[model samples]
Target chain A: MTWIMAALLVVVVFAGIGITKWMNSTATENANENWRDIAQAEIANSMVMLEEPDLSEPQADYYEGRIAIAEHRLANDIPSFEYASMQQQVIDTHMMMSLVTLLAVIMAGGIVASEFSQGTIKMLLTRPVKRWKILTSKYITVLLFAVVLTVILLISTALAGLLFFGISDGTLLVWNGSEVSETSFWLEALKLAALKFSSVWMISTFAFMLSTVFRSSSLAIGLSIFLMFTGIQAVFLLQNYEIVKYYLFTHTDLTQFFTGNFMISDITIQMSIVVLAVYFLVFMAISYWTFGRRDITA
Target chain B: MAEQAIVQIKNLSKTIGKKKIIKNLSLDLHKGEITGFLGPNGAGKTTTIRMMVGLMRPTEGEVWIDGQSVQADFEGSIQKVGVIVENPEMYKYMSGYKNLLHFSRMHKGISKERIDEVVKQVGMQNRINEKVASYSLGMRQRLGLAQALLHDPKFLILDEPTNGLDPAGIREFRIYLQKIAKENGVAIFVSSHLLSEIELLCDRIAIIQNGELIDIKNVNDLQKSRYYIQAEPLELAGEVLTGIGFPAVLHDKGYLIDSGAEHIPGAINLLVGAGVRIFAVQPYRETLESQFLEMTGGGEIAQTHTK
Candidate 1:
């Protein structure tokens, strides 16, 4: 079962790259011609946003930062990274992380629950080991599975990028408040992938909690995957409320701070990390508590 | 009988959803003894077994094995115990050998040779490499037994341990259980519906009904001295037995007298002197089946009576 899930992840990665190639080939011959003009237009838009009197402090900072990066790009003659560029592929590889999260949820949901379904939990729990220790071992196995899948995603994306897009001269520019500077695309890509994995970790932990609490893998996997798709949409729905600042989905994507995509303008990355930490704790607490207290009637 | 008990369950009770599944049950198992746990359906038999093995926590009291409390020190208590609850569910995707290996790793100091020895002991070496899904029920039972014996547990708890084995396989299993109980001095607690099997395998039997232990007796006590006599003129034989101050009860076409072998010859002489034609005489013992049914009220389901 694990081999099948891993194989499916690799297939999905290659299929994603294949689709990108097919789409890029159908575009006009001058597909790369107007990136410079697009950067200039983005700079003009951010400049206009900066002139609004009612713009919040973080909102104003966001536009100013965008304008600075765009102006720096226009001055340095640096174009926005195209979809087919090797550098962008490295960054876009994390976009396939949802699939990784799905695979991970499937595994975490079944690790403990499968024992009950197969009536093997009686055999397992009757061992000399403590119940908490067994649960801890299962949780570690789930985390290791997620880590291996992430590695597969990273290595596959790198290979696929080299094969299809080849090496391209692309400069990754980041604004450090006062100026824009060049950064390694590999470092940037790693940062995004790591941030994206936080979402995977949180969702898989939630699935693990459900699996332990309910002792049903289907319910755990189904509910977790459903929330994975709609959780962000809920952030959009709840954005106007003050409570949205503490909502889980709002903080799941830590990359929003670096990408300048703030759903709530006042919230800081530090606050998001704290919120995520709290959620992680709650999920783990529920998982361990229920697992230790459950009666193995199955 | 004077030896210390290896397994002691004291005032154990379990209440699941207000049903009071097990109510203040207590039992003691000694080394070199196989105690059969017999109960009708839904008589808290499985629940009691689960509690003993620490699969379910007791609402009150405790189970101790080899001087360790199962509730307080799970590892210390269960270290010397082997359990097979019901059908001995294994990972069907893995081979029988791997299943044993998987369980062997959970215990300390269980080497690869120990696993091989157990496989051979259970006579499963030929099919141990096959996946559990491909094995028949009898084969799975063998594998289950192999895994349970892998750790060489001092106290073995088996629930329906001989469910799917053929007669030959069952005899082999019964002999193996008896051997371990006697040779290794391991205490064995077996819960089974097979009364005749229990008669042949167990040293003592504990019977439960409606969440309570109704009786605990030695097999020997249930098989007290009695003899059946078949003769012509049963009335004359009964009178002669009465004349000799012996109680004889009519049974089938004969009379059954509770007597020893020494009394039987003297009684036979007296009957012959009275001209009572004796056809046959044999030792008589009641089957465990009739005794179990009699004790458990015909072995009816216990729950429906409560409602």
Candidate 2:
């Protein structure tokens, strides 16, 4: 089971890297020609939106800003950063961290629950080891698996980036609401990927807690995966309420602060970190309490 | 009889949701003794064993193993205890050797040599490398035994240790357990429903009925000598044996007399000289099954026994 999950992860990550590289390679082959065409098409598309009669003031400003960026790109001959480049791929790799979260969840959800299901928990608990120590060992192992898989994802992405597209020179442009400015793609990728890993760590910890509390891996994995999607959707649904500030999914994506896509715009990075830390503590406490106190009937 | 008790279960009570599963169960297990724990189904035998091994906590009282409390000092108390609770469930995904190695790591100072020695002791060296998934039930039991013995535990608690073993395997297991209990002076407590097996394996038997320890007796005490005599005119034979100070009781078309072999010969001579015709004479004994059924009130469930 251990080796199979890791092998599947490598295959999946490599496949994702291969597919993304293929999709992005065609656009960057003729960089200048492709940029000009893309900018013209983008300008035309934004121009139609700018012509809308009922467009709100901010909406109209957003479309006008997009048109301005495209026009400036064409005028300055600043082609959009090539997605096939190593820096861009490293920056974009975090987008696929949901896969890492999934694999980590599988590992965390089974680490302790499988012992109960297979009836080996009796053998495990009857030893000279205390229940708390056993639970701690399992929790540490789950954390290690998550960390290892995340590292694998990062390494595989870099390998794929290096293989398909060697180093490429391009300027990363970001519009700070009024004007486009230059940014370091490598720094941006590192920040975004690190932020994305916070979500993976939080979700996998949640899955681990469920695994120990319920002593059923299927239920833990299923419930965790289900909540991972629905919980994020719920943040948008509850955005109008005051409770959204404290809701777990609202803060799970720490990248929201940097990406200008906050579900609850009032929440700061510090607030999100605090909320996530609280949830993490509650999950860990429940896991330990239930595991240490549970009767080993299995 | 003068030996100190190595495992002391004192006033151990388990109450699960208003049901007293084990009611003030107190017993002492000494080294170099094989103590058989016999109980009907759901009579709290497993519950008591689990509490002793720290799998379940006792609601009241505690189990002390080797002068340490199992509830308070689990690691210290259970350090020298080997437990095989309910078929010795192991990680079937790994090899049998890996399973032993996995358990060996949980202890303080078990070496690779010790694991190999235990594997060889259980006669599993040939197939120790094969995954436990491929092993038969008997082989699994042996591997289970190997893991239990890995740490050279001073106290061994086995719950149905011979559940899947064949007759020969059971005999081999019994001999092995007896050897450890005697040679190594390991305090062994075994819970089993097999009456004849317990009779052969245990030096002392503790019988539990309806969440209570109803009887604890030495195997020798249950093996009193008596003789069954089949004679014509059973009434005359009974009178003749009773008049000769045998205290004969009529049972199954015969008179049962509790006496030594010398007295049995004389009693038979007097009975034959009288008008009673002696047809057969044989030794009689009460099986453990009958004694267990009698003590447990026909082996009904505890709920009925309570009312």
Candidate 3:
């Protein structure tokens, strides 16, 4: 099911890119041709060396304003056209991330929480296996699922993106900032996708911990989604008021690496790794401690 | 009545939210003994059993299984104690056999043969392939017992093992418990409010009420304490029995005389001479129902006893 959904998402994204490209090609080509015609007329008049084309002052001024306007349009038109396609790609990327994150959360939440919700934890807990081992097994299963799901999403996005846009050897342009060569674009995207996957995994782990603690799959899923949407906002509200940015969610957006934006000075990839590792450990620690001490009679 | 104690609780107490559910409860279950933990509803029977199985820790005191404290060495103690507290929750999506297999993996050294043995022991060998969702409540209970017995634990703690069983199911379960205790030497500590069922199944009985141990007695000992003596009525049999220093209650057909064996003949002779038809003399041992009522201070037994 996960692989199938990922394939479908790729198809939809490629279809969207195809339509955007077609629409912008026509608009941009017409605008470019119109400006080129004006530039040709100005060059022709300059070559003639005709008696300095004197005219009534207002008429001369009008032609000068027209030339300035056309030059400005010629300079900025192509980028504006490209920006339309880029914006759509950004939206698609975010949408894919959201879908992948949702799937990861559900998979992780279901692995353990389903047992508790269905009252099967009693039988499982009573077995000869140590309680810690049982929890560890479930955690590993969720992590594996997250990895597989992320890989599928990344592969699908690349396949769809290539099919929609004609192959060009130009560097992949990201928001006004970071650049990647055509040869490295796919690989870089894979790396970014994997990092994005880790972010999803982080969320899934948080949900898994909540699932273990609350023993309700629905509650865990709901809380996870709510946190995903509101977490950054809450962190920003706190950080904006002179609070430290040490909160885990405050640094969750990995776009800073792709967009050349940084929330703090001297922010490095290693710092992000450290912050996430600490967050993951703290979440897991609380979950294990609570589960170890809980009475399973419930 | 074997000598070795398999499970023992001393001064155990458990309170939940201001209500004392099990209070200073002490009891010993011997090896190879099918001891019935008999009590009425809300009598703290399940609470005491839960504490014994380490499902719930006692707020005060100790529980020892196989000579180890349940609190200090919970995993070790639990390894030797098999428990089915109330309704045993099982993975409904998994096959009954798979459930057993899953639980079997938890205890080291459990073989495939042992899993099969327990499945057969519970009489679920034929239907073990079916998912637990398709199992009847009786089957689920049997499966629960099978899982509990998976590791071949020395002590078995079952709370209301036959709570929702039909008559035949209950009978079959009782026989199974007896066979396990006698054949395997497993100490069976079972709790139920069914006095008649306990009377039939358990060798020894413990009565608990409102978190307190009211009495622990051998079935035979309790049976001997009271008897219904029915005999032909003498014209003055009621007065004559009382005058002879034995109290007698008058029934519709005859007098229920409470007299020693030695005095029976005298009462019989006197009743015959009083011109009353002297047809029969029968001694009735105390029924478990009356014994339960007496032990638990006349609390209301649940109505399911009739069903």
Candidate 4:
């Protein structure tokens, strides 16, 4: 299992690096094409460039701004178009969080189920240790694995991004609903990774709890990952009912609370935290009761 | 029964979803002894061992190892116990040595010397560095013993330890278990559905049938040794044997009598005095298979025994 996970991590990081390089080249070409199209449109309309240009197409307007900025930098004799602001690095590297979480969820689902499937739980349970300690050791191992994956994700993506897009000083942008705010790039990225990890950890805990209840790794991983992908959509479809806010999937993505994206209007971040805490305790309780008290006939 | 008790299972009952697996079973294991558990299929031998080792919880009652209740303090109670509930499972991805090292982390002060000692004790020194996936069944069993003995446990529980072993491997395993029990003062509780294996391995045999303990007897006392002393004038020979307190019954060509091998000469002399010419003297001792059949009441294992 350890070797498999290591092999998977290596494959994923190299794949991420390969894709990042391809994506960077394609993105630059696409941006240049969009810039040329804008220039042709302006020439056709015979309009003067304005400090604040009016455009009906939101995408076109955004591209026009980038083109203008590029022209200004070029006029200033800047040689590189691949110079990405720190904020762009954050954006370019953000997909890694999703990949790391997927890995974390799979690892979590395998924790107890693998032991049961392989019949290794007998050896573990027979040891001179309480079931709770054994369980806690597995849970802590999950968290550590998640942390390790996240760190690999962070480092690998950072290197990939730096290799593809030259780093430049820029503000980390935060949308305040009324205006954008500037923040330290590293701190903001850290906050985003931490928030993303909160969701991963919660989903992992859910999978870990499922692992305790189920004997098949495939069943647990399949169900947990299924719920992971479709849970929010299912919750959203039923969210009109006030009681749906208390559902587990509604609060699993603790990032929603930090991002101020409320699944329910009245479900505050603190309330979500409390709900998740209650769920965490409940997951642990079920694991304790089932794993500790139940017979291990297998 | 009053000897130093290493494990005491009291009224152990296990029911899973309304079907009772073990019913009101109680047994004791003493220090410095190898006790074999025997039963027919689904007779709860493994269930009882599971309950004893805290792998399965008893419906009512508790297992006390070294005076600490497994229910109340699992760690403290099981600390003195080493168990191989079934085929010993391990992380196949790890070397046997690394596997031992990993399990040693759970218990404090399980030294490097202890690990090496157990490795040598189980005779896995050469193969300890190889991944467990590469080991044979006997080697895996030995590695399992190495892991079980790493802590120098006072009590050892093995549920069907010889399931896949060859004859020579089984002999070696028995020798190691006997050595552990005698030299380390570790009480060993081994269980098997195979009666013959139990016969050769244990000092005392515990027979359980249908979730109940049927008998616990010393190997020497499994049954009274019975012999057939055939001779001419069978009726007179039977009478002469009975008159002399041999309690012989008339049989094919002569008589059947219950006596150890040592008493054959006296019986033969008494029959000759009665002018009965002895033809043949053959010994018959009750086997574990027959006893198991009688205890299980001619159930699943009867086919094997009768054949």
In terms of TM-score, which candidate is strongest?
Answer: 1
Q: What does candidate 2's lDDT look like per residue over A72-149, in tens digits?
A: 888898877665677777778778789878888988899899999999999999888988899989888877887777
lDDT of 3 by residue, B1-307 (tens): 5486888899998878898888888888898899988777778876777667665668999998888988787678888878787787788878999888887777878899989998888899999999999999999999999999889889988888997788998999999899989998999988877878899999999888788888888986766532344554444666666776767776656667555577777766766676545656777576888878877667467553543
Which regions of candidate 1 deviate over 4 angstroms? A34-42, A52-63, A67-82, A178-181, B229-257, B268-281, B299-307
TM-score of each: 0.92, 0.86, 0.76, 0.83
Model 1 over residues B1-307: C-alpha lDDT tens digits?
9999999999989998888888889999999999999988889889999998888889998999999999999999898999999998999999998998898888999999999999999998888888999999999888888878888899999999988999999999999999999999999999988878999999999999888988999999888899999987988999999889889999998899988888999999999999999999999999988888788888373342232
Can you tell me which runs of candidate 3 are displaced by over 4 Å? A1-95, A158-190, A235-239, A258-266, B225-227, B230-280, B303-307
lDDT of 4 by residue, B34-128 (tens): 99987777788777888887887788988999999998898898888888988999999889999999999888799999999999888889889
Estimate the overall C-alpha local distance difference test score of candidate 1. Answer: 0.88
Which predicted model would earn the best DockQ? Answer: 1
Which residue pairs of candidate 2 clash?
Answer: none
Q: Which candidate, 2 or 3, would have the higher DockQ against the true structure?
A: 2
lDDT of 2 by residue, B48-78 (tens): 9988998897899999998999988989988
Error of 4 at A151 (Å): 2.2
lDDT of each: 0.88, 0.85, 0.71, 0.76
Query: Which regions of candidate 4 are displaced past 4 Å?
Result: A1-83, A91-96, A172-183, A254-267, B223-226, B231-238, B249-253, B256-267, B275-277, B302-307
Tens digit per residue, CA lDDT, model 3, A242-264: 44456677567565554333454
Chain B TM-scores of the candidates:
0.89, 0.92, 0.85, 0.90
TM-score of chain A of each: 0.91, 0.78, 0.68, 0.73
The collision pairs in model 4 are: none
